[model samples]
Target: MIPSRSDWTKALEIRHGKSLNEKFSKSTVAICGLGGLGSNIAISLARAGIGKLILIDFDIVDITNLHRQQYKANQVGEQKTTALSNNLREIAPYISLEIKNTKIDEDNLEELLLGADIVCEAVDVAETKAMIANEVLTHMPDKYLVAASGMAGIGSPNEIITRKITKKLYISGDGVSDVKNSIGLVSPRVMICAAHQALTVLRIIAEEFDL
Candidate 1:
């Protein structure tokens, strides 16, 4: 069951301290995909006390996604936005969430995600991923973006690293790995990339905001 507001606050205070808890509760994040990387990154941000989330995706959960994505067997056919919101609300009951159950394209990009404190590009297709990353990084220069290049298969944990692509865009992953017949997406490596993205968000919004 989800904990009470006071109970949740106490837990977050213990982990992130009092000041960070306040800032996190006021921040907003937009996740452009709802796959392995996006799901995990959104959850991390929720747990860290982010106040609002803008979740966008057009895909539904599939059995194949179980290995790496954050959905259950019962949610096999549910929309990714619905499934993720259900899970996130259960964890962070008080978190405010906005869901866009649609596919992101160049035409709707700006309208879909505007005024977000941070944006994450976690789509699977290379073309869509690149498109969103470049658009957000170049157009929304003031906003921070976290993009993942590669996180397929069980390889060296150290291989996944966060690279700063620009002043506001950061890429996290091995940078070369791809999903193929020989290698598949695993939770460990995917989470590593997501971790870097999540932590970097915290660093920018909270840690360095005062600097």
Candidate 2:
């Protein structure tokens, strides 16, 4: 059976204190991609007891994604947001999950970020990433967007650093590698970038740092 509310309260009190739990449990986060970095970051946030998650991805899992994505080999043909939402629910049954099986574009960008406390951009394409950033900056000025770039191959994971672009936009990762690199990706570097993105989400949720 699932743990009771009191049980969760006791656990939080002993581990993170009431204020932190309250802050995290009430925040809603939207992850704009369910690729290598996004898959891991969404799961981490769900497990951390974020109240709600909005997962948006317009792609299906492919065999190539197995190297770094959190999904299993059997999930190759599944929709990315659907697969990720199922996995996150299995890990944290108490958290609410919303899956949007469509790409974030100019049309729906503002609507998608309307109520999100924080938005994470883990999409790999440069044009799409820039679009999301521009949309958030132009329309949703109050929300925070944690974006990731340069998580390809075995580059220096230590190079991943969070930089603030404005009062509401923050980016993390190497900021150098391009998708054209032939080296391919492994789990360690991807996980490091995902962790950085997750931490940025947590910081936004906790109100410890803005942007």
lDDT of each: 0.87, 0.84
Q: Cα RMSD to native, each candidate?
A: 2.1, 1.7
lDDT tens string, model 2, 1-211?
Answer: 8787678666765766788888888899999988888899988887777889988899999998888888988888999988887888777777888778887899998887767989999887889999998888787878888998787777777887888777788889888877687487778888888988998888877776754
For residues 119-175, what per-residue lDDT tens digits would candidate 1 score against the true structure? 988888989988998788778877888788888878898999888766787788989
Worst 10 residues of 1 by lDDT: 202-211
Per-candidate TM equals 0.94, 0.93
lDDT at 207 for candidate 2? 71
Q: Please count the clashing residue pairs in each candidate, in the order shown.
A: 0, 0
